[model samples]
Target chain A: MNNMRVLAEEEETSDGVEVTWEDQQQINTFAKLNARLKGIEDKLEQLKQEKEALDDLSTELELTDEDQTVLYKLGESFLHLPQPDALVRLEIDQASVSSQLAKLGAVAEECERGMKDLKVRLYAKFGKAINLDE
Target chain B: MVEQKFPESLDKNPRGIPKAPFIANVEEYIGGPDGDVEGPLKDFQDAIAKYRYMDGSLTQRRKGLEDKIPDIRKTLQMVEFLKQRRDRKQKADDQEDDLEEDDENSEGAKKPLTTTFELNDTLFAEAQLDDTDTVYLWLGANVMLSYEIPEAITLLRSKLDAAETSLKTAIEDLEFVREQLTVMEVNTARMYNWDVKRRRERRSAEEAAKREKES
Candidate 1:
C-alpha cells in the first residue's frame, strides 16, 4: 500500500499548478482501480474462452449416440459417462463458468464506476493540468 | 495540509532493506551552492526510465507466472485424480478377488475407459485409457519421463509450490519497482518546482536592486 500512497506535503505558493497531496492521492487511487479493472478484464476474457470451449464440447456431445459413453473433462481428468450424463455435466460446467463471468463483469463495472468518480473529482480540481487517461 | 505530512515513501522497507529517503527538499537534495538543477534532474529522469523498464519486465514476469501457476495446478490435479482412480480400481479388484475366484476371466474382459482426446487443434481422436500404474509427464525441453502415480504426485506438488513462491516474489518485485518509479517522478516534479521558485526570487531581487540604484 506504501507504493500506492502519493507524497503528502503542502506548498505555500501554489500558482494553481502545484499538485496537492489530495490530488495525488486521488490519482493514485484512480491508477490502482485502473490496474484492478484491467486484471478483471483479462480474467473475463479467459473465462469467456473457457465458456466457448464448453459450448463446442456440448455440441460435440449432442451428436453422439444417446447410449454412447462420452468423455467429460472434470478438472484435468476426463470422466466417461453416458451421452445424456455428459451433456448434463457440460451444462453444469458451462453454468459455473457463466456465473464466474457475470461476477467478474459486475466487479469490473464497479471498478470502472469508482474510476469515473475519481476522474470527475480530480478533473474538477485540476482541469487540463492532469492526465488521468490510461 | 501540514498535518497530513506522512513519510514520503509509504513502505519503509519494500525489499527487506530500507530505501534511501525521497528527495524531500529538492534544492538541498540536489546539493550545489548555485542550486545545480539540470544534472540531478537528468539523473532522476534516467533512473525513472530504468525503473520503468524494470516495471515492464516485472509485469511480464508476473503475467507468465499467473499463466503458469494454473497450468501447474491443473497438471497436479490430473495426476492426483489419476492416482485416486487407480487406487479405487485396485481396491475393487481386491474386493472382487475376495468375493469370488471364478471372476478372474471377467477382470481381463473389463471395459476400458474410453475418451476423446485432441490430437491437434480442433481435431479429436477417440482413445481408450488403459488401467496403468505409471503415467508419462512432459518435463519440457524435449524430455518426457514416466513416473509412478505416487511419485508423480509428489514431484508435481513440489513444482507447484515453487511456482507459487516465484509468483509471489514477482508480484512483490513489480510493486517495489512501481513505487521506485513513483518516487523518482515526484522528485523530478519537486526539483523542477524548486528551480522555478529560485529563478523567480532571483529575478525579483535583481529588479529591486536596479530600482534602488536609479532612485
Candidate 2:
C-alpha cells in the first residue's frame, strides 16, 4: 500500500504532459480545450431551455386574470395569495424575463467566439494536416 | 422547440489519434556484460517514453472525469431544489386549509386563497414555474434526455457514481504504470553498476596477464 501510495504521488506529480514531447503536449492541450468547449456548449443549451420554458410559462400565465390566485414558491416555502395584488412568489414579470433571455443569448455568443479563438490556436499548433474533426 | 445550432469550433479532430511506438524486447537489455549495455540503454529510454505516454493519457482521462463529476453534481442540485419546492408547496397548502377553517365565518375566507409567483429578481430569470414532474438531463456530446423528476435524480446519481468510479480506476492505472517505470529505473541503475564492475575486473585481469608474459 505504501509503495502504491508513492507511485500514486509520483503519477500525480507528472500528471501534466512533459515538455519534451512537443506533439503530445499539443494534443493534450487540444483535448483539454475540447472538454472546456463542450462544457460551455452544455451551458448554452441549458440557458436556451430555461428561456424557452420561461417564455412558455409567461404566455400561459398572461392569458389569465392578473389577480387570479396561483401557487407561488418563494424561497423555501409557498406563500398563500388572499389578494390579487401581491404576487410575491410568481416569476411572471415580463421585463425581467426578457432581459434574462437577452443576457443568455449574449453569453452564448461570447462562448462561441472563445471557441473559435481556441480552434485557431489548436490549428496553428497541429498544422492543417491535423484533423480536428476526428 | 428551439433549434440548436452547434458551434463549428466544437467539431471532432480531423487527423485522429496517432499510434504509439511499440518496444519489442525490454528484458533482454538487463543482466548483460559491461560495454554491451547499449541494448539495456535503449530499453531504458523506451520504458521512459512509454511511461510518459501512459501518464499523459491517464492524466487527460482523469481531468475529463473530474469535469464531468461537477456538472452531474450541479444537475443533482437542481433536482434537489425542485423537490424542495414541491414539498414546500404541499406544506403551504395544508396550512392554508387550516387557516380557512378558523376563518369560516368571514367573507375573506369565501374563496380559497392560492399563491402564484411574480418576481423581478436580478439573480434569477423571472418566469412562473408551474409544477413540473419532469426535468431534462444533459447526457454529454450534445445529447439531452427528458425524464420524470424522480427518474432524473436517479439517473444523475448513477452518472455521478459511474464518473467517480472511472476516475478511481484511472488513478489506479496511472499508479500501476508509475510502478513499472520505477522498476525499469532500478533495473537500469543496477545494470550500469554491473557493467562498470565488469569493466574494472577485465582491465585488472589484462594487466596481470601482460605482467606474467613480461616476467
TM-score of every candidate relative to the true structure: 0.67, 0.45
Model 2, span A19-122: residue lDDT tens: 22344344444444454456457655766676677667656666767645554443323445433322322354445446756775675566456656656766
| A1-134 per-residue lDDT for model 1 (tens digits) | 22212221134323466566566557766776787787778789989999999888878877889867666776544667667656766786789789989988998999899999998998888787677896
lDDT (Cα atoms) of all candidates against the true structure: 0.71, 0.56
Best by DockQ: 1
Can you tell me the CAPRI class of model 1? incorrect
Candidate 2 lDDT tens digits, B1-215: 12212112222222222222212222343322323566546656675777778779988998898777867776686576567556655666576688754332233333333433334433333343567778887777999889988888888889889998898778656555554455456556555544554555676799999999999
Give the CAPRI rating of model 2.
incorrect
Error of model 1, residue B165, in angstroms: 4.2
**lDDT score for residue B105 of model 2:** 26
Error of 2 at B13 (Å): 32
Per candidate, chain B TM-score? Answer: 0.83, 0.65
